[model samples]
Target: MSGLRVIPTRRRGQDLLYVCGTDGRNVAWYDREAARVHLFSEDLRQDVLDALGPFLAGAVTVGPPPVPTAAELVRLALHPDDDLAPNRPGEALLIALDRDPGPAHRLRTDPRRRELAAEQTVGEALDGLEGGGWRTLHSIPLPGGDRVHHLVIGPGGLFAMYALAARRQRVVVTDPLVTTGRREPWPLLRRVRSDAARASYALTAEVRPALVLVEPARLDVTGPPREVRVLTPADVPALARLGGVLKPADVEALYAVARDRRTWGKG
Candidate 1:
């Protein structure tokens, strides 16, 4: 779309509250849940309020499922950096956010992605890996039957090799975002960082870098780290096509790693 925004959300009473904005306008409001996304337009708020009726009944949950420990979140957030490898889940979260420079965004609640990222399952997000290029490596589950899969790409987009896979399926090229940032309607994930002291100790770090094509449109709430877009199915094809192309050596390497069961471990 023209411009987008994201707000971390939560329900109050029966309505939804979020921070929203477009290229030319923005605001934080507690409106009917439907109004948060479906109700507004560039012009008057007339249909905006009316459009919110259907979504007014419940509240929107914010963020992914909470991890067991703050440290665990730190690990997932800091993972997959160029200099460091995510060796152990227990030790991973100890890394500071500022260490890695790649952009990081969390997946929102949608049935399809949730289905793809089976909550608490080992291989919930394996679908992205089976194809030919970068595929899925791991998945994080949510309250609903949704999941968030992690992908990695090496080299560069047009000329690099990469890997993708569902959490359960053998890593394949079916889901490729590791190299080419081609997914459309992709969610806007906020970046997390850490101070220098922590960064030195963790040996893991990251920055809130923006994706190649994914841009933040608006804010969903008022807070330190913010929430961005909610992804929908409308974006699948572009992402798929971009991932399917076999042009980069990184993509080839990712495919090679995925095809070998010995490399994927139990997953």
Candidate 2:
């Protein structure tokens, strides 16, 4: 007990202090967000508390961890390599940039960097909805070198969202075609719907498609896209206001299935 160490770590933007024994096995962990110290054993309760004395703030709960839910059990059973929960926004691009950063000095900024920024902005917004009973997964890799920028599940139902880096450009949407600034129109909505369809196939559930434009100067929709929902970064939080399509348990179940890398591989 004298050799117990308190190690600090961060997970999902939350601070955690882990109390480890001399053998480096975790005896307890303090979740700052929950203001609780989860103990692995009752016998070591006082020892764990003593080890965390310097870090303890106000009143805090000291007890065994709660029973794992079915979703949590599934998540726990997954191998680290197969877990998609840890992926940050634009994870693939982040990896690629890390592998080859290209010329140190560039004539113009990398388009990938702009795409990454857009994903991060939208990803952070989606992640904020977690407290309101939503679950989001970022940078889900599909077969054929494609990816779903973000997958969101909540009372609003499931949506596969694609982030566009429109920045200060005007965006025009006409069916499957999308035009940004002076750029030529492309069938972007087709890809958005296709990604959603793949997600639906993989999860065996209804997955809607959404296009999120980041910081577009203006958005014009000549005619609403068939089945795709168009939005901007500021509009993401509105999804939390939607309900009746799913229950909390359903959201967790779908999230558990979706976070497995194998789930997308089959699609």
Every model's TM-score: 0.23, 0.72
Give the 10-residue window scoring lowest on summed lDDT in candidate 2.
64-73
Which stretches in model 1 have alpha-carbon errors above 4 Å?
1-129, 139-149, 152-188, 192-230, 243-248, 254-267
Q: Compute the lDDT of residue 24 as modeled in candidate 1.
A: 18
Evaluate model 1: give its TM-score. Answer: 0.23
Kindly list the per-residue Cα lDDT of model 2 for residues 1-267, writing each as its tens digit.
578899997654778897876744566789888899987567888999998999998999998554447667655568889999999999998999999888989999999999999999999989999998999999999999999999999998889999999999999999989999999999999999889877875765568899999999999999889889999888999998999777777787788888999888756
Q: Name the top lDDT candidate.
A: 2
Tens digit per residue, CA lDDT, model 1, 1-267: 323343444432444443343521223233443333422223424333333334455654222112234453343342233212322211221222235423446454433332322221222222332353434333222223322232333222221101121222221111211222333422223211111111111111111111122222321222322222122222322344444333454344433333232322222
Regions of candidate 2 where Cα sits further than 4 Å from its true position: 1-76
Q: Highest TM-score among the candidates is held by which one?
A: 2
**Local distance difference test values of all predictions, in order:** 0.28, 0.87
